[model samples]
Target chain A: MSATVYIPREATALSLGAQSVARALAEEAARRQDAVQIVRTGSRGLFWLEPMLEVATSAARVAYGPVQAADVAGLFEAGFLTGGKHRLNLGPVESIPYLKNQERLTCGRLGVIDPVNLDDYRAHGGYAGLTNALAMEPAAIVKAVTDSGLRGRGGAAFPTGIKWKTVHDAPGAKKYIVCNADEGDSGTFSDRLLMEGDPFCLIEGMTIAGLAVGATSGYVYLRCEYPHAQDTMTQAIATAYAAGYLGADVLGSGRAFELQLRMGAGAYICGEETSLLESLEGRRGQIRFKPPLPALKGLFGCPTVVNNVISFASVPIILERGAQFYKDYGMGRSRGSLPIQLAGNIARGGLVERAFGVTLRELLYDYGGGTRSGRPIRAVQVGGPLGAYWPESKFDTPVDYEAFAGGGGMLGHGGIVVFDDTVDMAAQARYAMEFCAIESCGKCTPCRIGSTRGVEVIDRLVAGDRTAMQQTLLRDLCDTMLNGSLCALGGLTPYPVLSALDYFPEDFSTPAALQAAKR
Target chain B: MSERKRVTIPIRVEPGTDLPAAERTAVLEAVNQNRALEGSLLPILHAIQDRLGWIPPRTLPLIAYELNLTRAEVHGVVTFYHYFRQHPPGKQVIYLCRAEACQAVGAVSLEAHAKRALGIDFHGTSGDGRYTLEPVYCLGNCASGPSLMIDRELYGRMTPERFDDLIAADAAGATSAAATSAGATRA
Candidate 1:
């Protein structure tokens, strides 16, 4: 019998040299004349410990990592094939504290199954949701999602059920279900993680969405940066089509549903629903005015259900295990688990999928193990580039949508980027305006002109030129952008700038304070 | 920050450069593959860029003619997208993450190092046309900060030293490949 070895093929692990490790293991095994099978799986989200290797033992899968190609020969010498003891051995993979603590409802099979193999996906209870959804009526399916209390994980936190209901109820012969896989936010890779780790899960979720919304055609508007995910999804889509999971008469249920993959060309604004729709139509990715929301008229002037990758991916679990089951997990209106990506300067940075109400301190300290630099963590930016910078005093805030909002923060896409004491809050504030300036779709005056002005004001403030007046001007500019922009791209850019100015005033006041003291 | 500079540069058509008959056929084939689909402009442009290294000015008319759209309409999309280059790229394209997440972990200095080492700034190709450096917002490898992508392969936890090694290795590979092709020509 051949020994089965698991190595992650996801982008993060691949970036860390997982391919060379796989090759080294294969070469070592062949040199020893031993038969071993290497299965490329998705990352388990323990990024600090990747190129993580797992050897299937009789009792369980033994883990070893932060492994490199150079360590493969040493691993073989240590008899790691039969779960032999080594310096890098991490015991059972499941027992890793970083991974074991999380509630992985949406990310349960992330690193467990072969990404491209359909049979492996099925063996792990993959299609149960679609199978269960197939027997039920479309309205019932919508009700199931609604009752789950799931909201948009793409930062808006709008009720997912309500959005689906609108598309389901909207009178249209040709409604479209567009999966927003254009994850443009920095420090947010949960969407990319899920798409690369379990491509079929996203496919199944989109299929279930198609069935529920009575839509025949679905498109995944993926970003061009995720080449690995794009390839994985393209392959998975073909496999789903071949296996009767995607085409017309899906699973012999006589329901027609087709899925296609479309790549976005380097436009951050395209993550906006209207901009995404326009980009899909092969036009400039500029934001369109709302009132006739995307639900009513979208994608070639048809009613459409545009959802984030995580939002659609969370549907299968809702349908598989009743709505009450998913709703039982989270607190308040924020139901189910949030896949929080812990990134930037953290010791044990990875994906932490926990239910809402988990405090920021718990994620920052317990899960992340503090900053990688061993210095005091000055600020942690929850959400993405547009998210607010939370000071140490505000770290006690729970990871709920309303709770974060109340504390002048947002749980946008659950991406938390930690910064140590060496961070410059003033630079971060300036960057917020600059990022908005770069990515704004130019349709709105406040976002387009205001952001560039915001950058100038911040520069003046940072450079000690009229510091007091510039601070007030910066706030006024933020308000204008917050109220006057068309989409979140322009609207939310103020969060980071204002929060940085509010939390770390010392960073911004240094040059001014020095000048004042000199006087 | 200067009231958003909107400079509309005229598209430069290099005179005396005609699309090869075979390349023209390939462009038409690409157009034909996607012309039947709704909103085929982006896909058609991507297909042409994929077959040919970049979207040549000559191919735009062929694509416009095939898709029944005006040349300006096609040109607008090509220019709107940052990924679509008007000229051919170098042998390798290095997309360095310039976003805040990467900036938190020495990406600024790393960017400086990359520019100095490559002797090129963002969107500039090296004199030998061996490498082109481009700025990317993020590569979704934020957990491992200071990430970069060379063509399709992503590299993380990058430092100035590691970046230099990568460039040297790529240059060596290019040199060897050139040697092999030159030897074949001599034979």
Candidate 2:
């Protein structure tokens, strides 16, 4: 009989030699005159331990981690197919501490099933939400979500149900439900994982949104950087259309909803809702003025509901388990589970989906296992590029949206990038400004010209010209960018730059000056 | 200090003149295939670039004509996006993630090594037309830092040594050449 072997088809897995490992497993099996069936599944999000391989045992799925192509022969020789012991064996998949501790609501099906298999999805609790949603009134669905305390997971912390309610109440010839999958954040992969791993969750979520908002049309504005995600999502969408989870009659509910996958050409600003709307309309991704919120008039002047992948993906479970099940998990105003990504120079970096209020210290030490270099951690940048650089003193702060905002940091998209003691905060601050300059839509002068000037000021400061006049100028520039800019791309850039300057002022001083002052 | 907002190459061409005859047909075919899509300009531009590796100057007017927009409107849209190339790339395009995640794991050093080895900076192709280097903000492989993508294939946890070896292997045809050929055939 042939043994079943599982490998991840996810992006990070493929990037880390999963393809070659799969090939080696097959070739080695054939050469030994033994048969092996390879099952491609989504990643479990223990990314540093990829391409993690699993074998189907009768009792459980036995896991082996960080496997290279070179480990194939020795593994077979050790009788590893039947869950026999090997040096690299990570035991059962569920027993792993990092994955075991996670409270996976939206991400429950990730890495647990064959990604593109709709039957496999149904075998799991795939469309239970839609099934229940089809029986309920649309207003009740909106009220359930609103009562569940589900806010937009895409950094802004807006109430998801309120946006849906706005779209639900608005009258238009056509309404839209747009999933902002343009995840351009530097240290975030939660959106990509869900899209590639459990795409049906997003589809079901979108269907529920369409039903709630009376929108018949939908679009997923995905970034061009994620071609692997595009391939997986496209396949999943085709599967969905075939299975009646999408298209004119969703799950035979006698209602209509249609979805189209749209590609965004490499503009980070498109992650912003208004700019994304502009790009979806085939125009330049420039920031639009407010008073016409996207909920009121969006997507070619129609009432559109734009939500992030995580936000949309969270909807299915909210609908299935009802409101209070989700509301009971989180803390304070920020309710429901938060999927936090740990990246950069961390010892064990991956996605950690937990209820809100988990502290930074716990995420960094208990889960992340400290820096990958085994050095003292100096700084950690919470949120994406526009988030604040928190110091060691602030490690105990809980990962609540309001808590972070109160502490001069915002948990933007829940991505945390760590840096060791060797990192230069001054250079990081300059890079933040430079990143703003590169991705800015050039609509407002504050972000367009202010970022360039900010970079020059940081350069001058670190180049030993740290005069008070220059420092004041830098502060004033950040203030202008914060208050005067049109969008968050311009408005929130000071979060990183000023946070760096405030947290690590020594980094802004030249090495010579530092040496002299220390003496 | 400039945003690299517009294409550096001045675009001026008649609809039926100075364009490669075969690619023009391919361009028109791409436009027609996507003309019915909502906000189809981006889809058309992507199709042309995917088939030909870059959008030709003359093809812009053709796309505009098919989409019922002006040549300048089409031109503005194409230049606004970073993915659509105005000039042809080399046989193999290398995208190195220079974002903060990759930087934390030694992307800067690897970037310098790649530049020195290739004898060209970012957005510059080698004299042999074998390689073109582009800086990608993020490929979302954050845990395994210093990610590099050669054509459509992605590699992670890259070091200067590994980068050198991989590109050498690419030059020697050890890696898949399908993406390269599909992009290079009409360029």
**TM-score of each candidate?**
0.95, 0.95
| Model 1 C-alpha lDDT per residue in residues B1-187, reported as the tens digit of each score | 5698789997644321367886687787887898777788888878877777688877887777677778888788788777888888898888999887788788889999999998999999999998888898888999997999876778889999988878777766753321211012111
Positional deviation of B138 in candidate 1, in angstroms?
1.0
Q: Interface RMSD (Å) of model 1?
A: 6.3
Instruction: Kindly state the number of residue pairs that clash in model 1.
Output: 0
Model 1, residue A102: distance off in Å is 1.0
Candidate 2 residue runs with Cα over 4 Å from true position: A512-519, B1-14, B177-187
Q: lDDT score, residue A399, model 1?
A: 90
- Per-residue C-alpha lDDT of model 1 across residues A1-519, encoded as one tens digit per residue: 579999988888878888778878989899999899999898999999999999999999999998998999999988888899999999999999888899999999898888989999989879999999999999999999999999999989889888888999999999999999999888889999998889999999999989998899999999988888888898899999999999988999999899999998888988889999998998889878887989889888998999999999899889999999999998888999999999888999899999998999999899999988899999989888889998999989989999999988899999989889999999899988998888877889999999999999988887787778888899998999999888897889999999999888889877565695467
Supply every candidate's count of residue pairs whose N, Cα or C atoms clash at under 3 angstroms.
Answer: 0, 0
TM-score of chain B taken alone, every candidate: 0.81, 0.85
For model 2 the local lDDT of residue A311 reads 98
lDDT of 2 by residue, B1-187 (tens): 9687785886654465556887888788888898888988888888889889999877877778777899899888888888888989999889999988888778888999999999999999999999999999998989888898876677888899988888788778877631211112112
lDDT of 1 at A287: 78
